[model samples]
Target: MTLLALAGCSSPDGGSQASPTITTTAAQATTAASKPGSRIFGLSDNQTAALDYLTTLEDRHAPFVSDDRLLALHRGGEICVDLDNGMSFSDLVASWKPELREDGAKLYVRAAVEKLCQDNRSKVPA
Candidate 1:
């Protein structure tokens, strides 16, 4: 929940960084992914597409673009870990700061789960 709000590689003991996230058309995602250096090496093209996809989301609901991409990946992994552990939607939402509670937040989380958190992709909240 609130943990997702933190950028990658962040924890309660450490502060988080800012990044951009939000909605985009599949075409935009593809176009972004096509650009050289658009993706960090070591990730599959699909994975990179996912990252680019996240960037197109509405920032208020899924703010992820302004942060370092590596850290963003870290956060997505953490979210998957929690999901794998049976973290619930209620609990997830409870962890959010009031201002961070946006309707699209769940969708944002789901996209990360599906794209970045492969093992937990099926665990996305209902």
Candidate 2:
């Protein structure tokens, strides 16, 4: 009876959720993105210019892109760039759907980006 009860208690799905395995490449990128400094790589001149412009905006503002904000923005951009060179916030989040099930860190990274983007929308060039 106890054995039957135990079996009955098992999840109908038959397996526990699996954790996401953050790839070494992703990890490295994340580390770089999370760093407390300006990031200059893999950007076209235009993109670099745009980033520079944003930095200027940050400097002008009282609560500019702090370390955490920079990390989130950079990491989010990295994930987007990896999934699709021209990926936007919506696109990157969509691509990371599968990863969210396994690892929440990706979601965290994405959220950080979203927040940064939201906060900096005024600074973004049209």
Candidate 3:
């Protein structure tokens, strides 16, 4: 009886638990996707440039900015941009390529940025 119980416990299908490894890349991708429109908010060139500078500084000196500053910049940029000019979320997503690349934020950053732009645009006066 004890031998049978041990055998059952040791069975490959019975005791093997599938462990999903979450790598930094995977986590970053998940974070980017889950947040949707959270990194870029369709800012104008001036606003984009200023935020870019701030983000660069944060990236160089303050890693914490990676977590919160980017979101704040996105919000501020959305407020600064004149959305009545017909800018779409797709445009903002495309525009974020440089920043995303610089930050190593994952490929989905573009999609997230675009989603954010779209979400912000949705709230604008149409």
Best by lDDT: 1
Off by over 4 Å in 2: 1-77, 80-85, 102-110, 114-126
Lowest summed lDDT over 10 consecutive residues: which window, candidate 3?
1-10
lDDT of 1 by residue, 1-126 (tens): 322533244547687655444455677555433433333221233445444435534343465545444445545444555665688655655554353454545655565555544455455555
Q: Model 2, residue 16: displacement in angstroms?
A: 36
Lowest-lDDT window of 10 residues in candidate 2? Answer: 1-10
Off by over 4 Å in 1: 1-53, 56-61, 65-70
TM-score of each: 0.44, 0.24, 0.25
lDDT of 1: 0.49
Per-residue alpha-carbon lDDT of model 3 for 3-44, expressed as tens digits?
A: 122123243656754343323354553443234333334232
Alpha-carbon runs more than 4 Å astray in model 3: 1-71, 74-76, 79-82, 101-126
Which has the better lDDT: candidate 1, or candidate 3?
Answer: 1
The candidates, ranked best first by TM-score, are: 1, 3, 2
lDDT of 2 by residue, 1-126 (tens): 211221233346886544333233544444444432323232221233224333443443313223333443345445534433344545555565564432344344333333322332322223
Q: Please give me the total number of clashing residue pairs in predicted model 2.
A: 1
Query: Could you list the CA RMSD of all candidates, in the order they appear?
Result: 11.6, 16.8, 17.6
Best by TM-score: 1
